[model samples]
Target: MGNLDKDILEKIDDWLSSSYDEETRASVQKLIDDQAETELIDSFYKDLEFGTGGLRGIMGVGSNRMNKYTIGKATQGLSNYLIKQFPNQEIKVAVSYDSRNNSQSFGQLVAQVFAANGIKVYLFNELRPTPMLSFAIRHFGCKSGVMLTASHNPKEYNGYKAYWNDGSQLTAPHDKNVIDEVNAIASVKDIRFEGNTQNIIPVGEEIDPIYIEANKALSIHPEAVQAQKDLKIVYSPIHGTGITIVPKMLASWGFENVTVVTEQATPDGNFPTVIYPNPEEEDAMALAKKKGEEIDADLVLATDPDADRVGIAVKNSQGQFQLLNGNQIGSLLIYYVLSAKSDLKQLGNNPYIVKTIVTSNLQADIANHYHVAHYETLTGFKYIGELMTKLGDSAQYLAGGEESYGYLVGDLVRDKDAPNSCAFLAEMTAYFKSKGKTVYEVLLDIYQEFGCYQEKLISLTKKGKAGAEEIQAMMAGLRQNLPTTLGGIEVKEIRDYELSQTTDMKTGRKSEITLPKSDVLQFITVDGDVISARPSGTEPKIKFYCSVKGTLHDKSDYLSLQNTLEEKVDRMMKDIVG
Candidate 1:
């Protein structure tokens, strides 16, 4: 009791006295009754800040955690904003969730809150991918949408992702405006907890077919798929919502030899297979990779819990299964989609593509080779979705991706889509197989054509109050003391995204960055190396992205050249943060 802070005690008391259910209230009271100071402080330290994207944290009964009350408040606030924004409208919203511990319950809570506020809700009947929620919003012409997921976070974590009518997450004025509204709900009494069952419509069976049908039309090479229909394909959902649709998406594209990793196929919030359910982690995709080896599969794919991002493994030149980093997968996806379409002389008018600034520049090079317009958005897929909506009717979107294994194809969904990516990726593999090539060979060819591009991401997680402060201090130190050189290359330019300014190191000339403000820093070397450091918006971590270039005139030099670039990038990162 002595260690518990005064403010934390007050917050705990509020929850205890509020209309929270007996279990929830008892959970909160137990901490106080047992004199659990540290646990109590951690839970009640501060209200989980609903960031630009939405709420995410450990699930528990406290202000600083993800619980029914916090999610309900966010829903009530979003409902208020929707009603105000679309006056005299039906005010429909799409609600879906992943298989996280409380995702289904949280999704129900969201539907109930929205329904209580006189908003029509189309909720998923079962766990579904995050992208499907985006698709539902567009298909139903809803005013907004919310998905209950933490993407690839750990088992204890859950989150909320809010989307706009255009099928994209909130951007610009809307993001800040929604934050304002969420903050305006100063008390639990202000939230509408009771739900109107009439207003909550269970949806999914009708939407899945439409989503699968829409994804099938994105295939650029049906003949190739037909020719190589027996392509060995292995995939795992990592116990997320991907199993619900990925296989169907693949089958819809004419893939006949698809194998599912049975052990990791079920939708379990506990994510018992791997420590972190993220496909980005090798252990998480281990089952799929092993299955690929057992069958000597042509390719292997795994999606995160929400199925918006995918991780893939292909046979390298050595005939061994190798996992493709996000950059490589995204680059190949763009290359195959654009090249196949461009080669067939089907380049549509105003063809456009997108990637995050931290992603590989090879994507931009590929876009340029086909004379397609490309734009670099800030780090989030929401920004890409926002740009797509901004360029509506004027520019046709071909594809867009980030380095974090998230990619979207066509204009079907406004978010990064894994199920859609799986369909296209399998199709891309089939097309390559039809050409007597492997996915790795095409990647090497792309490197041979566009020079070898290598990029690496390193994230440092600092948790809780002290960790947050340490992250801020590290950024401040780096900002105040800019490195003169990294990886033995001269620093040519430094871009401060927070200040929206890019300054040339030599001439000391500063240019304006047109994108919105963000806390990011980039240092470009004279030798075509762009190293960026930015903090994660969702998780408590800082990510360092190192992109380097080298010549790959000979395919035999792929492994050595790649290793050299990796060490160089390591040295470059070492100079800055280590």
Candidate 2:
């Protein structure tokens, strides 16, 4: 391209002369001959980074894009690391993909790389969700695994998520060490393209039954499900991998009346039904909501592309459909699990649940009422898995969730699983229905027992290189000028997770925080409001989490208290941004 950086030109030349496929070379040459300056700069300006999860980028024919070369390099690097980590043992890895375009080819490419490197590979015969990949790794006793899907992202993007033997994403030293090995890859020629087909074993039929049975074992009230087997439920997979297992899981859990949104039931990479293939958006769930109304269903559930997160809709007190945010869902799930166990006298010794620091504190109050231990980790699910691994044999993990619709019920799979969550959610609906109460009534009852807690998340996205720099600058500005008061209330404490210290702003006394270092800051006000600021690890955006609470003495006061909390959150956000 004309006026391109010299180094970028050199990289382009290298790719042209390298051992890449003919199609890739033709695309690069066309861009150069056409003098596509903007396209060239965006494609070749920098290399795509393998973050804590693994590789994710827009697919194209450049170092910064997700293509055959980048996928091969990541797989080779992971092969090398696994070989070193498990010396003297036969290293094995599992591979799976989603319904996205080219995902099957990319997944086969990964399996070939691992097999070429003399590593045993267990590849799925067809597309599966990310959670099943995690379960397969632990079930087969593989040393590592890789999943090829961009969870809830747009159609143009794809990603690779690496997992360890414990079935969790990389954490701490392992994550950084994998990055070093990937960066050391010098050329496309270094990747092994030819493979021993015998080393690649297809796995699906053997694992699906076990996985489904394991989830069915998590149900606490099978009797209630049997009694209320006719509870009308509507579901939509949003044209993702959930269509493969979610319906099957529901059937096995003794639910009789289940309706699938036929239009959105098929798995398609283009996601033809919605603008964004995410359950968090109301527009994405519009079709399912309409289906629920026509059928007079009691609940509506929607899952994203990879089926890792789930969102639900239920009738409110006024007999109108209302969407429950992630915080509300998490609260209801934890309350159901804990209270059921307590009622059955199944609360064992040292029982615990986990949540992220950005999640609602209502979880902690629920745990206190049940006399169970509650642990808070950083924002990622890997951190929750890490804590679970660390507390091995000392505590039992009941369930855990984040505020972004990701959750897990048992310890069999370390990652968040929608199939498992859906099964339990259906059971939860049946249990309350058996008692002649709607889910909305159960939620109000929970709030009345424990104070009403409302939370909102606002994300500001910054796009390319300049946008990244601007996000960092915004964080720096907040750290440099700490607000003394927010929402007309005095600031009581400041917790700087980056420094691993909590400071009493009124007295200037600091206390050590016993958690891993992260670039997050939290401001706690005298009125019991919490404001947290942190950047997204997977996307080019920064997020602000605001939480407020009020007394809900009666069902009539619900609307008034909700309005007051919303106003308080608005004021706090304004103060922080100003």
Candidate 3:
């Protein structure tokens, strides 16, 4: 450990002298004795800051890692925040954990710290989905909540997602304030790891019934699901927490012919079946698609590790199983919701739809077809939740979704709930089947009614410290040298969300954008194509979202039109980067 600073060296020494296990101490000692400069530097570089996604890192023993000490400090900070927020009342908080490595232990640590601070804690008895934690916070009338999960990250990671009483993740002043408290806790000694056993409550069946009943209430077409009760649906959880309740929820929705992918059904943190447990990953859904093909199922749905995001596969025009991208699924869900509500004459004139700025604009097209309002917020489910809170009383929120496969059916819960989405998606498939059409056919019909909108997401990951700097520089370069055109089309409007302004290149006219400032840039072409560039908040990567649209005159031309749109997206990306 040559050239190691006194502070880092002393921190390691303190861990060695503290109550940390012997194995962790021995690993630190071995690194010190071997003079492993790189390992020591990486381990002791800096404390892992509570990011937008809360504390997420590889499970290990270090200031920058996710371990008992870090989790404890975070919980203590949250407990402090809760106390400050609710000074007079008796504060209670709900806690849940996913099926990740160390998730349960970390959850218990949180509950213990909260209980030690004289706060009531309702901790889930075992592994549970993240959305249920969100739901429980509102249902149990808690002041705050914490979910122990790394979301769709790999097995080496774990996380803590802090929530307010609104059932959404912290935002604005609260998020920064909680971070300040966590940062103020400079030492593990500041954390209270012991608890009054009476204050820590383990919750399971008592709350399960409530969550399932609420999810069932989100069903837009129970009669449709009842009619198509035997609709063949293949489901998988990708070895995460979804399997616990998703199948049961489907059965309750009257879908009796659901097939669970046995290989990926069990909850294992190792995620032995796939490299990434994220439903966005094709490898994770390969088995489900295989089962779909064998059984000729109507739809194949899989949720992410925490069950917050759901991805589905539908048979295309050729009767081959094809995965619908996040944008496609978002459009279909929005289309069905809006169309069904309009058909039933249940839509209020003040009804509105919410979607993240990064999501497909096809939703906007559909919303316009029904004369419903639509609003776009920053790139987070929390912002959508905030809007729902803001407009809950005056304007009705029909539905909202993001480009990342997260959707909210109603305002019952404040987060993207896969359990509810899974049931609703199954109902959508059945509804189309009742109308003598496949889900793919409904999607095509929507496209034919609107235009054929195709979207592509390209994420370029820049890992580690140096990669972070590189990404920053790239964003700066784009802002400095804004492109005048893309894909041979004139860049008519440039929407710079950071500066909260839209500039017309030709007229040199600038106007204000009213949404919250984010590091996203959108270039709209004269031919009605959109290209957006944004950097990831939680991870070290930058993503570019490209959208191109055209008309599909017939179902036979779907594949050819899709290919053209793909080419348009590719050319646009190249022009922007080049």
Model 2 earns a TM-score of: 0.97
Clashes of each: 0, 0, 1
Distance (Å) between predicted and true CA of 270, model 1?
Answer: 0.3
Which residue pairs collide in model 2, if any?
Answer: none
Can you write out model 3's per-residue Cα lDDT over 1-578, one digit (the tens) per residue? 45678988877887787567688888778888888876676567678778655887778777778888888888898888888988989998999999898899889889999999999999999788888998889888998899999888778888889888888888877888999988888677888999998998889767776788877887878899989999999999999889988998898889999999999999899999998788888998899999999999999999988999999999988889999898888888889889999999988659999988888889999999999999998998988887887776899888889988999787778889898889889999999899999988998898888999999888887865567788989999999999988988889999999999999998999999999788999999998899999998765679999988999898778889999999988899998765
Candidate number that wins on TM-score, 1 or 3 = 1
Q: Which stretches of candidate 3 lie over 4 Å from their true place?
A: 1-23, 33-36
Per-model CA lDDT versus the true structure: 0.92, 0.90, 0.88
Which runs in model 1 stand beyond 4 Å of their true positions?
A: none
Worst 10 residues of 3 by lDDT: 37-46
How far is 18's C-alpha from truth in model 3 (Å)?
Answer: 3.0
TM-score of each: 0.99, 0.97, 0.96
The TM-score measured for candidate 1 stands at 0.99
